[model samples]
Target: MILLKKVLLAFFGLCAGGVIAAGVYAFLAIIGVFVRLMGKTGTRKHIFLYETVIILGGVIGNIMDIYEFPIAIGGFTGHLLLGICGLSVGIFVGCLVMSLAETLKALPTISRRIHLAVGLQYLILALAAGKMTGSLLYFWQKMASLG
Candidate 1:
């Protein structure tokens, strides 16, 4: 019985990990495509609008996951809250970076450098958000196992 439970937990963990990874990848890919599309127009307003939507989406997704899943496991609530907080911070930072980059456009070279940095920062944040969601799923599974 114990072995079976361990096996099930392991299986679920992998599933959760895969789900998170895939979701994050898809989200990033979509954002990248949107940014590229906006870049074609070469307008600061469009870029800002795109960034706003992406940040809003990220926040909404995290909130949805927290509400959708059962948060009965140890530390699950705290983790979820922290994840939400982190997502908010990330969004703010991403927007700030983008705004700064837009302002630096006159110095073409600096703008490119800032854009890369901002992109990387957002990627890291998105990955972290995905990881938190995965952890929440794993915790849910473990809690379910107890019953």
Candidate 2:
């Protein structure tokens, strides 16, 4: 029956979505994002709030992204909001990358293999600068091409 097929499809889709969500949450937990924040802040009192915001933000962000929602906050306030969002996203991504590298011991292994000593901090700074430069160049080229 047509109704039965639709129901089955919908059920499978929901199950798949649930599985993906669980995997994403597990990844975040394994990366210790929340734990890092708690450790840096020296407070666990707002852990619930932090967790709630992360969950809601993920859901709302996905919904907005999928639906192509237009957030029409124009002018200076909009620019400020955009800047804040950009900085937050950049920081989150930097933290995620560093944590993943640490988990894999990639940087340490590389440094050791290269016999790098007394310049690890400079190497990190150089890597960060290179990433920033590359990101800016990529976006610049994309914008130029668009225009």
Candidate 3:
């Protein structure tokens, strides 16, 4: 009975993880991240390579996170590596955000749906500003907590 329970738990865990990964990838695809990236860089020929990198990156990231892998890098090399990682993450996030914003066109659509014709531009500007402010506040709080 104990062995059966363990098998069932492992099976369910694997299934759940697969589903979550699929959902995440699907969302990324739907948001046009890959399409936008390739178009911008004229890397249509290298789409397969781009996709493989994304998949491998996800797997390695998950493994490192789940296994709590520790980095032993120190000094200037460590800071340089950290900076590169940060820049890569920032670029990815910016691309993702732009993809989402372009794909959704949410503010304009909402304005049209609600017949809010007059201040639609202001509404979009306000939404963007609000997002920036919220992001700044959240990061500020996170930095405070860390220090």
Candidate 4:
């Protein structure tokens, strides 16, 4: 049924979003570990690499969602708005992770605390980003309905 198809599309979109967020977080965490091992000199390079991966992952995820859904529940304006919102959420999460990493770096004495704090911050950001991405997909469904 049409309703079932819509539900499936929404589910696919959510899965794609979750995959992208996980990729971003994992990439950053790996880079952080690498930087810690390599010392301060390689930190900047690793950070840039991590950011690039996030951006690419976000783009691919959005494209995959659109391809899988292909139904506009609202209108062009709504779809555009949703896309922008999703992008904004991704960027915000990246920036938040970076800031938290910087803050953690300042307290070298509390290594375990720093790791725990960074991990928690990343988890929270991922959850927020996932929620925003889901909203975007919902808007997409609404756009499709309007058509």
Q: What C-alpha root-mean-square deviation, in Å, does candidate 4 show against the real structure?
A: 16.6
lDDT of 3 by residue, 1-147 (tens): 999999999899878887998899999999999899999999999988998999999888878877898899876687568667865886798779868977888657787799997987687678667876776677658656755
Clashes (N, CA, C under 3 Å) per candidate: 0, 0, 0, 10
**lDDT tens digits by residue: candidate 2, 1-147:** 999999999899768877898798789789887788788888788889988988898788767866898889876677568668876897788878887787778988989999997798799889989988887777658646745
Summarize candidate 4's per-residue lDDT along 36-117 as a digit string, tens digits: 4336355565767866865787778777766795646466676677678768766666555655666567334444655664
Say which candidate scores most in TM-score. Answer: 2
> Sorted by lDDT, highest first, which candidate order results?
3, 2, 4, 1
Q: What are the TM-scores, per candidate, against the unseen true structure?
A: 0.27, 0.77, 0.70, 0.26
Count of backbone collisions in candidate 4: 10
Q: All predictions: root-mean-square deviation over Cα?
A: 17.5, 2.9, 4.6, 16.6
* C-alpha lDDT of residue 48 in model 1: 70
Among these predicted structures, which one has the highest lDDT?
3
Judge candidate 4 at residue 79 and give its lDDT: 65
In candidate 1, what are the lDDT values of residues 35-131, reduced to their tens digit? Answer: 5445666765776777677768766676676569664644667656856866666655554444445455533564365676446656556766796
So what's the TM-score on candidate 2? 0.77
